[model samples]
Target: MRPSFLSEPVRVRVPATSANLGPGFDTLGLALALYDDVSARVAPAGCHVDVTGQGAGELPTDDGHLVVRAMRATFDLLGGQPTGLAVECVNRIPQARGLGSSSAAIVAGVTLARALVVDGDQRFDDAAVLRLAAELEGHPDNVAPCLLGGFTIAWTAGPQGSDGAGGAGAGGGAGACRLEVAPGVQPTVLVPDERGLTSEARAALPAVVPHADAARNAGRAALLVHALTAAPELLFTATEDRLHQDYRAPGMPATAAVLAGLRAAGVAAVVSGAGPTILALTSIPDEHLPGMGWAAQRLAVDVAGARVDRGRLGHAERDPVAAGRKS
Candidate 1:
């Protein structure tokens, strides 16, 4: 009677992210040139991910992987499950390299799953995507920016009572925004020849930071975000942070050395997500990047977030920016 509730498979492309961006620990993030492509072909109840490209050798090949987990969770949120899903992944972004590889997968899975599960109207809501991605990534800083793109500020607040894991909003409620990336800017990413620092390694930062150090970090964080949105000239000054970078030094040897060298060379690079990649936000052009030595490659900023293509399913197109009313 309901036309059989059939929807075509979907494709999603998500960009890798560099979180922290100097002093904005667990807050600031920028989308990068590298990417992960996820294509879903609907079959008949289970979902699976096929690993290829960059992380294939190291990453898992089954449903136990983070991406598959996120996709299945998306089905649960959308009401009922489809018959099955075969996910083809062409991952160019390296895992555990401090790039937001996990966040990228989670984003692609959620966006793709949403397109597959729902009807023409009640698709994955703004809050639904954000909340689920946030919960999966363990924090909103990297996940939010990777999902929304550009420059975003987000913070999570503790619930009023013992009620756990409430998605009230991070930083500025809904905690996402669209800021135009300055035209000439190119993010020089330095991914060291190292493995990665897990989210657990990141969470191990010393809880009690000196008040003075905290203030210094706060200043740099505000300056970095403001520079990104307002004045490009302020980026260099804003890139200095006294927070997580130094604290994370012991665990990430390459990260620490890269950050130190970049700063000494006046590039002011900071730890990218969790470890071996250092990101230098600059409009200084190509010649300057190579001099820093920690670089793998350099490219322009991709402000646009994940993109999903729908073949005929309701003739829908996934709008990366149209998440709706900022609650």
Candidate 2:
């Protein structure tokens, strides 16, 4: 007989995330209000994935799906036999647009694995989940915010460090740390119709930067954190960067133009994650930003991060009472 926990499905919702936020560069990230919900159950046989909304038709519907792969990987890490899963994904975050779509999927998979197990067992806590997700995602920047919510400062500590675990198969040893973001900072995103791959954007960066530029960016990154927590008015100067953006500009001229125009207008704006999408830190409302025929939305800082709910049906299959409880 199947265990009681396996009698029903487990559903997880993970928020979209924006990384870098300008000068932080693979270190700073924050969660946005946007979300992707995934529901998974132990299937009788083969794995099946059904995707909706963003990337519905293009994404694979079999075991090759990223969410499924993440789930299997987590099971392996737990020293448990992999189970065939029936997974349904309702994706809201745009793909390959600098937003953390893949990170969200990775988080959802890990969360689902933790949620499906018996409660009394050695549970997969936040720290364990973060370590596993970081290993899967290759970095903690996006996954940390997706798991921890709010703002996150992610770093890999040295071998003697007290926190974090080393990357999968990487020779260097280090522990990962994801610190919570202080309050009062909000983001407004300018999403372009075109998409940009993270790999391509990463390849554009030069191996070495001038020492002066490096030093300046370091100062700005420190100031940016202070500005975000206390004096948001200083955001304009604090969000400056000397790395990654200019090199990625040629592939996203329109996005670069919008970013330049916003900064020139005294708004603190920078390329979100890799390219194409621009994240502007502002107290002003979205309706007030100059409409340049692009999609713009004001996003609240997500405080809840990824979560799981049991004994309830999927969003598409929920009853009114269940929906009310969810709300």
Candidate 3:
């Protein structure tokens, strides 16, 4: 049966996220205060997207857009497609700066599509949202935090939740655990002007790594959970990674140098996802210069992941320049 569409527009606020925080590659993620505001309404005919902030004129304005594609996928899951879609996006998150912009778009699309359907929640629940979003993004690390908020440990679970050890590799359902960050934990992102290709970064990583390195990463990843929640002081040691960073450093020399410098100065710094951007989990020393094409922003931890409301883009949300932080 075809699903009933809501006449009113539905909007979603999805936070920017940082994935693979050090050792927890493809498993751990953090939601930051920066966000993208997207609103969609059922239309009578064609699909149209009005993008403002980041992508603006560069992104596709039709169904080819990531947000629209996600929404179409969602509508299909909800049993039918609306006649058309009119999407408005006031994007604040950088497009390809390792800030989970793609995941944010995917989450926003799924959330809005679900809200636009009359009985959407009943048909596709929150867990289904996570699962679908993860499938769309091909990984749960970024989508989990963007959807559920805070610090999330996400993995792909096999039949009966038995695949606890799998992180996107198990290929079943998406599962995540959200935890509130410790009060003392501060997140500072050093964003660069150049964009990075996640595919390129992944290609740079070796197919195999030493066993000792994997063991070390496992221990630190475990400690990272505790440090992020209960002991901020231990974050420096806990955020260490023996995985993807070093191998991909040659491609992103600037990020590698800055990360090394920050760590030497006692800051818990890591390459944000597949980088050119750097995420510092601890306070940086005053001497550190965030200049040289790197814009540093100290962001808060967003506890409320993706928020949905029944409405179109208002004055502030349509501004394109202003980041629509929920009041």
Q: TM-scores across all candidates?
A: 0.84, 0.87, 0.96
Any idea what lDDT model 1 has?
A: 0.70
lDDT of 2: 0.77
Each prediction's total of clashing residue pairs, residues at least 3 apart in sequence or on different chains, is 8, 2, 0
State the lDDT of candidate 1 residue by residue for 92-134, as single tens digits.
6777887888899898878877777546226667656876898
lDDT of 2 at 163: 42
Worst 10 residues of 2 by lDDT: 318-327
Lowest lDDT sum, 10 consecutive residues, model 1, at 318-327
Show pairs that collide, candidate 2: 164-175, 164-176
Q: Rank the candidates by TM-score, best first.
A: 3, 2, 1
RMSD of each: 6.4, 4.3, 2.2
Model 2, range 1-327, lDDT digits (tens) per residue? 222246578888788899998899988888888878788887777888888778889999997888988887877666573356788887778888888999999988888876776651365556678777877888888998898787777765544433444542132321234444445565888888888888888988999999999999999999987887777878889999998888889888899887888888778899999968899887544444646556777788787889788743456543322232111
**Pick by lDDT: which candidate is best?**
3
